[model samples]
Target: MKRNSLLLLWLFIFWSVLIWSAIDPKDYPTWFLEVFPALIGFVVLAATYRRFSLTPLVYLLILIHAIILMVGGHYTYAEVPLGEWMKEWFGLARNDYDKIGHFAQGFVPFMIAREIVIRNKVFKSRGWMHFFLLCFVMALSAFYELIEWWVALLSKEAAAAFLGTQGYVWDTQSDMFFALIGGLCAWVLLTKLHDRQLREL
Candidate 1:
């Protein structure tokens, strides 16, 4: 596809999901909380389209992440049908859809960070760049936990749905761990593919 045609298709899908998610979501506030990052991503992508277009792989990954956010927004992570199915199928204690979100939190953002750092020559040493990206993703995950904390403090009713902790005491720690795992996965798995895409860019 031509670049413009591809961009149009991406925009179409994004808006379609955004609109669907907004129509009678599980809860307006929770939906906003979940989808706000996707909104920001859209804006950032638009702003950088001309001056700093991303690799197609990165764009596709961002779209996937946005879809995850939109779906979670529509149903709330704890009640997503897919997660419910997984819980039943695996005999798990609770819905684990939120874990997927947390994993993507690191997975997609790590690659985005990697692209920016490498393209901009932010760090000379590969080891240092990798270390920084790890810390960056971990910090991002930790900060997200703090946001959940603050939100729960403000609204007790929405806490369970937003955090989707499902009575697990170690939820916060585990969420960060999953994000760390995600970051490592992105670093190990996508680095070569990302490098090739970046070269094409």
Candidate 2:
């Protein structure tokens, strides 16, 4: 399909999901907290569309990530039906959809970071580029955790749902760990594909 058509489709899907998420969510505050990132992301992409168009792969990944956020927003991550089902099926202690979000947190940003590095010629060495990419993703994950902490401190009613920690003591650390792993996997799995797309662009 043409790029414009694809982008139109992406926007349609995003708005559709956003509207669905906004309708009688479990709680408005929790929904706002959860969906805020996706909204911010959409604004950023739209603002940068002319000057910093991303690869189709990156756009699709962003859409998937936004959908995850919206779904989590609508149901609250800890109580998402899919996560609950997975918890039962896997005999896990908590709904792990939040973990999936964390993983994507690293996964998607790594591509964005990698594209910037390559496009801007930020690093001379591939090794250094990869190292810097990992560092950037780790820092982003930590910052998001801090945002969650601040949100929790400010709003008791929305804290549990927003945090989605699900009583795990190592939630913060594990979230960053999963993000790191996700970044590593993205590097290994998507680098060549991303490189091809970058070349095309």
Candidate 3:
């Protein structure tokens, strides 16, 4: 598809999901907390669109990440129907949707960071660039966990849905672990393709 058309479609899907997510979500506060990042991302993308046109791959990934966040916001990660089904089918302790979100937290951001570093010629060594990307994403995940902690301390009711710990003792650790895995996976699977796209730019 043409770049403009594809971007238009992405924007349409984003707004459509945002609207659906906002309609009688599980709770206003939890929904806001969950979707706030996506909203902020939209603004950032718009502001940077002309000055910094990203590769189509990155844009598509961002849209996917946004959709994930909006869906989680709509149902709260613990109560999402797909996660609930998986929970029952797998006989797991709790829904794993939140884990997927956290993974994407690492997955998408690392790509964004990777693209920025590569396009800007920020790093000379490929090894160092990849290492820095993983570290950056892990730090991002840890900061998000701290944000959850702060939110929980401030509002008990909103925290459970926002945290989505589901009684796991090592939820925070596992969350960052998943993010680390995501960063590694993205690098392993997409680095060549990302490089191609950057070359095209």
After superposition, candidate 2 runs with Cα above 4 Å error: none
lDDT, residue 117, candidate 1: 98
Query: Model 3, which residues run further than 4 Å from truth?
Result: none
Better of 1 and 3 by lDDT: 3
Displacement of residue 161 (Cα, Å) in model 3 is 1.2
Better of 1 and 2 by lDDT: 2
Q: What is the lDDT of residue 23 in candidate 1?
A: 100
Q: Each candidate's lDDT (Cα)?
A: 0.93, 0.94, 0.95
> What tens-digit string does per-residue lDDT give for candidate 3 at 144-185?
999999999999989999999989999999999999999999
**Per-residue alpha-carbon lDDT of candidate 2 for residues 136-200, written as tens digits (9 for 90 to 100):** 99999999999999998999888988999889999999999999999999999999999999999
lDDT of 2 at 123: 92
Clashing pairs in 1: none
TM-score of each: 0.96, 0.98, 0.98
Cα error of candidate 3 at position 41, Å: 0.4
Q: Relative to the unseen true structure, what is the C-alpha lDDT of residue 51 in candidate 1, on a scale of 0 to 100?
A: 97
lDDT of 3 at 180: 96
Higher-ranked by TM-score: 1 or 2: 2
